[model samples]
Target: MARKWAGTAIVIYFLILVFMYWYLFNGDTSLPEKWVGTAADPATFLNARELMLSEQYSQIRNFMFFAYNAFDWIVYFFILLFGLSRVFERVAASQSKWRIVQAAVYLFLLSLLSYVVTFPLSYISYNLSKSYHISTQTFSSWMKDGLIDFWVNFGQMVIIVSVLYWLINKSPKKWWFHAWILSIPFFFFMMFIQPVVIDPLYNDFYPLKNKELETEILKLASQADIPAEHVYEVNMAEKTNALNAYVTGIGANSRIVLWDTTLNRLKEKEILVIMAHEMGHYVEKHIYIGIAGYLILTFAGLWLTARLMNSIITRYGKVLKITGIGNLSSLPLFLLVTAMLLFASSPLSNFVSRYQEARADQYAMEMLQDKDSAITMFQELTRSGLSQVNPPLLVKWFRYSHPTMLERIISVENYHTVEK
Candidate 1:
């Protein structure tokens, strides 16, 4: 009877999710009416449109993205339902450290298995990017990066699983709160070190070489009350032609980084406009705000995960081959529930991101008072990145971290400055 009830609950939950998906995606077919700015030439717009929204390339890419996501969920479910995770746990059960070694070994095996299962889809995605001329990474270089990424993830997973199991065994009832508190410092530490440490592992970064451009950017930064220091440029030309710039790190590690492609392709005015936008993130303290929001979400997610996992294990521990909530063998169940929770919360998280991005755009426009440059910068961004001007409403709600290109262009076109 309990199993029947659990099955019914599962069915209802998925039914609701399916309905929400349908509601979000149904009958939403809108495109931007026009482009903005003096540089928005018809030829450029047409080419960008063809690249972004054409049935041949962009549509295929979008479909592949959706299919790949579905495939990932399917794989996870297969691992869980077929007792594969249990089999891995048994293989590692005799390891030392009283479950610490077991947890590490289990996570290592799980990570390796996941990589093997997903490698085909990963390869397809890369090949598609290459075929579309969006990726400049050679196959060999891509494989090298993939290996590096796998090892990094494996190391991180080992640490995370070990800590989580420790917490679980130490205080099963309060581990969620403890984990939440512990995660705050670790999260900030990662953010602080990412620009200086992790990023360099993948790409080469250098101080922006153009003194003239750097001087102009520093002046703009000073005006915005952002710290005027060195601007960094990354060597991304070897990987792709996408134009991007951003502010990363905090305090001493904080700086603006521009893709070399942006410097090579855009005018000085456009680059400054992009720089101003990145500075807006710092000036407005969006990073700190984002971190706070993430912490809150993490707390809630952890708390809920604890409750659900406890209940599920209490009811069906033997059936699922999980000894208890504290057992490292239950990691797959924990992951499954966490994935579902995060997937459901994606819209809310994306909304916050998009809101901050819009605020940064407004701040940049007001500071620069160069609507033409802002407009043209986005036009170039859409063109160079082959970004959709207006994606489906569902995609915009869930996937987009910034306003759609059309939305941004229209906002700039309609923005009116008030006299101070």
Candidate 2:
């Protein structure tokens, strides 16, 4: 019976994958007819083309990326379903406050094991980035950041898993709903603290040193009604040659951040155009909307997970060596279900994100009123970042949060129709 149910579960999981793929691939992917001059400049177009990976390089890189993801997923599923988690639970069973200790130990082990298993792929990726002239960080600096990330993630998982199990024990049948409710505040708290507390751990941040540039950026923010008082500069050159800027945090914590490399590399006009894009995110309230969308998805995902868990536990409780949902040993099973759900929902999440990004791009073009600068800024970004002009359709659906650089350039080039 357990074998039968497991087969059913596998079938259902694959069916969901099939549906997601179908939905994502069926979308219209053609460029607009009005986007005529997007790549009309021979020099800019050739520069963008040069930034793209060679056919052979792209194949190898894409293969490595896909293989790494597949390997990671397999390792996770094997560890969880093959009873490694149960082994960890048994190791902590003799302790006082065993459940809490078990949760902590299990999570720590899980995180450590994941990192260890995935490190080879990560190392390869790092080498690939360096070979492509993307990364600037030394191996030692990379390892340091990796170590910091491990501890940070371990601590975070311990807190979250502890709360999750506590809620499960408190209301075995309705814990999913309760956990969903609790996660709303927890999610916001993480966002609120991330820029101030978490980010500074990895790199140094300072107020933007270019006073004239900062003044101009603030003026742009004012024009966008973003309520931003200052711009920040992060030491991204220490890690990567790539340039980036972003809007982060909420309310008083809200600020625009630029990579120091961006300041050094882009002209004043180009930098202001980038600032306008960041300000666009703020003015459009993408953060708040993103949070709301996440919460809704979390609610649905948790509810589905609960249903799936109950069914699985009923059929394979003894076979999987788990008693019930509230059991501390059930963490791996719970995680497996949640991870699968999240993976299956990637297209939906990416769709929303792409929409938000497109809107922000449009907003930036309107606010800057400098189509030439916007186009040049994007071209510069594409060259510096080694971004693909156009990724394959499935890649864009599954992985891309922003429109392809080609799509973005075309949209801005044909701004009048895009705004409509």
**Which numbered prediction scores highest in lDDT against the true structure?**
1
Worst 10 residues of 2 by lDDT: 51-60
What is the C-alpha lDDT profile of model 2 across 1-420, one tens digit per residue? 545645665675566555544543444433445544556232445444453353223444555654555555556556656677677777666564656677777777777778898999899988988887778999999999999999898888888888898898888889999999989888888888889999999999999999999999999878877687888999999799788999888767876899998988889998888887777777788887888899899999999999998998898777777877887778777877887788779888999999989988888888777788878788777667665566567667777788887778878877763344
Residue 342 lDDT in candidate 2: 81
TM-score of each: 0.89, 0.87
Instruction: List clashing residue pairs in candidate 2.
Output: none
**Candidate 1 lDDT score relative to the true structure:** 0.79
Candidate 1: regions farther than 4 A off: 1-28, 32-44, 48-56, 417-420
Q: In model 2, where do residues sit more than 4 Å from their true spots? A: 1-65, 416-420
Q: 1-420 in candidate 1: lDDT tens per residue?
A: 435644655575566556555544453444434543333332455564455343245445665555566556655555655677788888888676566678778888888888999999899989977877778999998998899898877777777788988999899899999989888888888878989988898899999999999999999888888875899999999999788898888778886899999999999999998888888887888888898899989999999999999998888776666778877678888888888788778889999999899999988888888888888888888767666666777667767889988778777878896665
Candidate 2's error at 30, in angstroms?
Answer: 12
